[model samples]
Target chain A: MSAIPQFGNWLSRRLQGSAAASNRRGYNAARHTDMAAEVWVIVRIFYAASLMVSFAFITPTLWKIAIAEPMLEPRWPVFWIHWVDVRLGATVLLIANMAAAFFAAPLYRKRWPRVALAITFFLSVALMLSRGYVNNSFHIWLWLTFFFAWLPDSDSRASLMDRRFRYDSVRVFVWATGTVLLFYTLSGIAKFIGAVPMNADKLSSVAPEALAHLVTKQLMISGDESVFGGLLVQLPTLGWPVYMLVIYIEIFALFALFRPALIPVFGWALMAFHIGIWFFMGILFPMQPLQVLLLLVWSPLALRPFSARGAIEQLPLLGSVVFWRRTKPNVSLMKFWWADEWPLFTVIAALTFLDVLPELVKRLLAAM
Target chain B: MNASHSRKNRGAILPLIRATTREKELDMGRKNNRFKAGFAAILVSAYTLVGGYGASFNFPEIFPFFNWALFSFPAKIYNEWVVQVIAIDGDRLSEPADVHLIDRFDHFGAGEGKVLREWGKSVEQGDLEAAQAHRSLFENLYRRSGAEQVRYRLVLRRSNPVQRWEHGTVLSETVEGEFTWVKDSGEQP
Candidate 1:
């Protein structure tokens, strides 16, 4: 009994000592813990923006008149749900899609926030199925929602600008980057594969005429009778370069996977590409450019300002080099994929630059 | 005596605070990072696998990824499909009269002619099933729009969309397919 009191007194003194120590180191510890959380907040904001752009930008009822028949197969297993009046069903889907999108914004990293994300995914799928025409671009949104919904909620609802990096933050970055890269690779594969119809004479090859024809057909179907597309039809020679350029961009988009710094450049190129498509084809892929913005460019712009000269940037030539080094990258492919071999990878990347000059020369010669 | 009593109170509370903080650290430390990442990974992989399979097979209603294969077409094929509703006054088919509700720019028509346009496309694509599926609905709307006896005639013409867009409608070689549905007489199946 006497020994128990003595032990309690000793424990109390130890606790008091540690508590004082914690107060002294509190700032650094708090900052370190919050780094991941801050990054997550940025990502959450981007997700919300993407949701708004995708679900809210278009008039929900625009497709109602075009839905002639109920879909042959509904995405949900509840077959009887399809029995509702088509217009009423479509309206419900549209309303639900918008509601979920509005609520899922900010991705609070809590249970209810996750539920909202889930609802958004299901409703988006339902809306796509409800229409006579479904855009495949929405698939990436669904996959993103699925990943985000699984993230653990934050302890406190602090501002996302807090510079905390956490386990979940890393996971989201990896998953999102992987998904975007996979999409680019798949697009490239689609072009290279024999799936596209070729001319009868050139059974294996895609003739320029055939590609030109398809562009014209797509534009007409979309109600875009643009003069630019008409000009392409009149000048058959322009078709080859345009088609090849499209293929090259689609393939090269894969490079962004290895070098995250190239994402902003890629995003701008994608926007230009989409804008061109809109002008010529009269079809707008709204979600794609938005996806590029949220996935690639938003992170660095949020984290680092170009004008903020770092310690390295102040040094002459070395400072410029350091400035590039200090620029906050969302993820370095070399560091993430092979941290030990990053130096070797950098060397390899440098070596490839030599080949680039020769390749450009050959291309110019060929064009001539 | 008063100062000693105050110190005792704080001393009692300090151990509890330390114990609680330690408990929180243990809880946070034990979080299964792998499991969290694994769940998302498995879900994305499974979805992509199923989606890719469905897309490759060209299954209708499947989320299409490769629907527009780039650089594969050898020729451009552009076709325009038009649907004209002609009223049948006894045996004489009147000069293709417009169905006001379906074609006219009203709340019912919405000015876009979406139904007629899509219906025409279905016919042009040789998707007879899709074309036939909405016959009753179209006829009902036509009757509601004040057409007592009418038949829908589909006219398909091919032209480059770019040319068509720039230079008004130049419909070529009309191929006609007609579906007759009269309000009192019922639909001609």
Candidate 2:
């Protein structure tokens, strides 16, 4: 009996010592922050908005006939589910997903409902995708939403205005950012490695020609011939450069990941690239506009404020405010990553207004 | 002496910081998350390798996005629009639907058209394996579209991608392949 008591005490001490060592090493609270109130608020809001917008655009018409009609005989399901089971599951999940998207739109820091919403959202997307030939464009959106679902619930708004940053939220935000960056980098690497090598026959290369082929076919089938892509197909020199630029963007995305400040710049540039794709190619990647609205606008670094006259005064050649008394607030070049800043968010929201507002309007009009 | 002192020190803290249920749950959650993150990183790295070396190494099929071959444009410069011509004649149809036919079957779902078009392209590109793999499924799909006899044609409309609009002319249209429709008796439209 005495030996057993002694052994218990020894075991308890060992466990406690290990726990203390772990705590001292700071493994439990790595990259903890209670900062970036404004950015966090915007992220939470935009994330919720993306979900709402996605649900709104979902045409239930895609799966309605599925209940009566069997799935394509040749199609592969991601997992084995009976035909009747799939129909019932699809109906239930679709309805559940829409409801979750609606209820979780605010994205309050509630654990249970948020988790429930995330699971349903994931299942619904998987079902939707598995039903057809997968369009990989939607994959990023689905995964990003799933990441946000796992984020620790908080009064995100309270954190936004509060000066002290929540370490947990910041960690989650950083992980989300890294994951998105990783996705882009992987896409780039894939493109570079899989690139159709340059050869005597230009069309034999898949890099630029395939994209052109796909878009032109879509445009021609739709009975529209006036797009710039049609013109590019005619001009090899101009088109080749554009194709190279795409491969570069996909591969060089790795560099953009480490430079946190440049994330916004990369996001905007990618957005422009996608817009060009939409113009030259008739296929609009549906999730892209929403992604730009939510993720691209967020920057962990605060932008340095600028003043024109002050800049002119500092220039050697230019007639300056040096000719007169200069007045400008000196903005610090370095800022705490956790500091709240709204200018970038405001600017991005303004730019994306033309892109997303129309869809919001269309959805409203359809409802009406 | 040092061991005894350390033991005494551990006992003082151990009683003060007993592993509560909440603490234990947090620890488990953290461990679970770390495992998930590590696993995800490994999967991503594996996918990257597969994308880069898939042609050299015979790996299982990956997602089209990860295939990397999606962007591989051929080096030889010839502009051509690959088009599919389907001719169908059926029992209750008002008339035989030719290349430009619009029907209820066409509008059923977007994926069907896209995948079918891709399959035709793959065949035209001389992917024998793809064509062979999809033969039965393709037949079934054709039947499901409510067509009795279907004539399938893959035509290449040759033009300069850059100057296609400028010339407003097809240099040549080559028929890559044409197949007569044979019905599988067991399959119903």
Candidate 3:
């Protein structure tokens, strides 16, 4: 019973310490921003490599369909297709898009190259999708590269603003990491929604049979059979636990923003999860796992082993419980985790509490 | 005096003075941190609201901010399409053999399967014009399979993944269509 009070006091101390750390990370703009810039440059180089590799991916198909394949019912107007002989244009733009990614990666520090790369990549992918060869892999890169391109390039000479407050590279990092996290989290939510009976309000338990069914279904559809895929079908319930972990990780991915520690943890978990899918399902979404690896698992922040302990200690409510230490509390006010001191943290707790507590509190008060 | 215990005299007042002094140091960027707090609120809300809207519905083709409905479609039973290439030796049907057409377009396994199914559906309904668009893609696939000239038969297979896995059973299979082509310089044969 006495330990409960100790837990509260420890939590209060941890929040105060974390608030200080977050402030330091924000205030030391040069240090953190430079780190982010370094990561940006590396990702740029990798993006370029990805584009160069696509040369092989694109040439084989050769957009023969552009001239021969019908495009009568494109999702959007085939204006780009109509602009310059669809086959010639797709060939030229795709080659240029890959070339641009290669060049843009190295010269991204220059403004025009970065902007040009974004637009060209967007156009090339959009053009391919418009031809109705839509792919899940394309959409993953489609959203990530385009939106992530907007993150502040600290070294860019061209993007030197006309007005607004200069967003430091670290904030840009949060925005980017947050975006990736949001992608996975919502995907998990989508799975939960899927588990429910169509047009129903309740979520049914995930049965082993269900996962087995999914494995069997993918194997037959793709014809890219794997012994592991066959095993999932044979075991009937081998995949539910693994499937559950994947859903939980994806759903809780955004919590990494508050904790910052789960960055590498989730990154590695997702990468492994993706590899499992590729081997078992024969559906290779190569770009998505690669992006998660680059942005989350191997980011500069994630690699900071010693300093990250402090960040790890800021894992919302669990930090204090996991890493307890005695500290004398001495401020004009007692610090609270869900308060102004830990503003970033407050949002997560506040949103959750607002939904559950405020209504309950209001009723309690009324009863009183 | 336990060695593992995290305690220092527990008197509490001496550390209190030290904490008071530390608070003053922490105040240097107090106002700036308030800005981070505000931005944090904005960031969380923007992603959840916008991305959540995309998730709750099915407008995935909208690009970057699309739904993540990867395997959300529940699967006890599903459909699989197979295209078997039959060799054309002279004027006779050279006895149909099982050809894994999917292996020909192995770069993107799942998507290529969907494309094959769409073309098969067109053939089933006698929509040759609609099917014409996919012919070249299939032609390239056939060429890659080292095919010289062949008749392609589309088969529709339906089964429960778990039942087949558990009991080594399949529900049903039916042939959808049979078609062939020949052309020059990257022509279909």
Better of 1 and 2 by TM-score: 2
Model 2 RMSD vs true structure? 15.1
lDDT of 2 by residue, A51-127 (tens): 66546654263254344333433222325445447566667766776777666766546655566666765665555
- Separately for all candidates shown, the number of backbone clashes (residues 3 or more apart, or on different chains) is 13, 35, 2
Tell how far residue A365 is off in model 2, in angstroms.
57
Q: Which sections of candidate 1 miss by over 4 Å?
A: A1-42, A47-59, A62-73, A83-96, A157-165, A194-196, A199-211, A234-236, A252-255, A299-368, B1-59, B63-74, B78-131, B134-151, B155-176, B180-188
lDDT per residue for candidate 1 within A91-117, as digits (tens), equals 655565566666666545554755675
> All candidates' lDDT scores?
0.49, 0.48, 0.56
Interface RMSD of each: 16.3, 14.5, 9.2
Which ten residues in a row are the worst by lDDT in model 1 chain A?
A15-24
Worst 10 residues of 3 chain A by lDDT: A157-166
Residues B119-141 of candidate 1: C-alpha lDDT, one tens digit per residue: 66566678877666544434544
TM-score to native of every candidate shown: 0.58, 0.60, 0.66
lDDT of 3 by residue, B1-189 (tens): 674443654555668878887687566344445555555555545554554444333222444445555665556555666666564523444555445532332233454565676676676768877577665555544443433465667777666665665565768878866766443224422
State the fnat of model 3: 0.26
